[model samples]
Target: MTKVVFITGASSGIGKAIAEYLVEKKYKVYGTSRNPDKVKDISFPLLALDVLNTESIKIAISTLIDREGRIDVLINNAGKGITGPIEDTPTEEMKSNFDTNFFGPIEVIKAVLPYMRKQKSGKIINVTSIAGYMGLPYRGIYSASKGALELITEAISMEVKSFGVDVVSVAPGDFSTNIAAGRYHTPVYENSAYKDSYAENLALMDEHVDHGEDPMVMAKAIHHIITSKKTKIHYKVGGFMEKFSVVLKRILPDRVYEKLLMNHYKL
Candidate 1:
């Protein structure tokens, strides 16, 4: 049987790229968005799903299952970016980010596991970030959220492997997407302690994204992982230096690594 795939946050960016690429490969693909009716000209079915809402998630999953009778892959790609000094960013916003980035994916996975277990096969791909490997300045909460999901993917993979289900996270470096526009930012107030530095770093962040790698790179990487019989718990896709930073964090001393990040961010 040809595999059936479901992707979340497929309205744009990396998720859309993956959905489109998979369609070209002839897999039965279903994409999701908060408002599917607004997105047009897609090659696959785009359903309405809001990861933050449980009922919405349930409906989207069941709708696809009812129509196709199976869901072979679940790509948790719906996430929002957040940037600002930790002190300046609101605590509620931090929790909100976790609700979408961390809790939301787990909810979707919970809804899909039963079907995968019954069928004795499935794969989950989580779109994390290279930022998750370390807490970058002004992006600490985003890092923490994705980092938590990365570990959750490991635990889930171990628990479900015996049931013929696999879970993995793909952490990408800067990508040229509208993520900057979608992300929430704490205003850089002139009187605030981090005003000048935060303002400069925010500009740098946008510059990195403006020149970031293509979303197709992530799409191709996901395609390869989905097809590979053997897979690792964590798969990172990005420029050589971006990926190497993860390795350096593993080997470098704590303070030394901190210095590198601070220097890189010009903090």
Candidate 2:
């Protein structure tokens, strides 16, 4: 039987790229977007899903299962970006960021795990970020959320391994996507003490994104992970420097690594 793959936030960007790539590879692909109407001229079926809404998630998952009978792979790729000083960010806004980036994926995992466990085989990939390993300057909350998910993915991998389900976290550095269109900025940044630094660092962030690797690159990496017989617990998808930075963080002294990051971001 052809494998069934369900991906969230598949309307565009990395998620859409992954879904399309999998479909081209002959996997039965079902994608979910907050507004299905927005996904036009797509080759795969798009289901309406708002990850923040529990009912929406349930409906989307059930709709796919009803039609496909099984979901062999689940890609929790739906996430939003937020950038700002942590101190200047409001409590509610921080929670909202966690809701989308952290809680949303957790909920999806829960919804899919039961079916996966029943089959005694499945793969769950959480599309985290390189920023999760080392928090970014102006995007503290976004990093924190991804960091949290990374740990969750690690812990859950062991917890579900006995059931023959494999879970892994795929952290990608900057990718060429319109993520900025959905990015949120802290309201207090304009008047806060970090305003000037925030402005400069935000510009640097945008520049990195503008020149980031193509989404197709990460999509191909994800495909490799899905098809490989030997699975890794964590995968990093990005340019050489970006992937190497994660290595340097592991070996460099605290102050030394800190200096490198600070200099890279011009902090």
Quote each prediction's TM-score. Answer: 0.99, 0.97
Tens-digit lDDT string for candidate 1 (104-148): 999999999999999999999998999988989999999999999
Worst 10 residues of 1 by lDDT: 36-45
- The runs of at least 3 residues in candidate 1 whose Cα sits more than 4 Å from the true structure, single-residue gaps closed, are none
All-Cα superposition RMSD per candidate? 0.7, 1.1
Q: How does candidate 2 fare on TM-score?
A: 0.97
lDDT of 2 by residue, 135-210 (tens): 7788889999999999999999999999989999999999999998799976544568987888888888889899
Off by over 4 Å in 2: 187-190
Query: Judged by lDDT against the true structure, how good is candidate 1?
Result: 0.94
Clashing pairs in 1: none
Alpha-carbon RMSD, candidate 2: 1.1
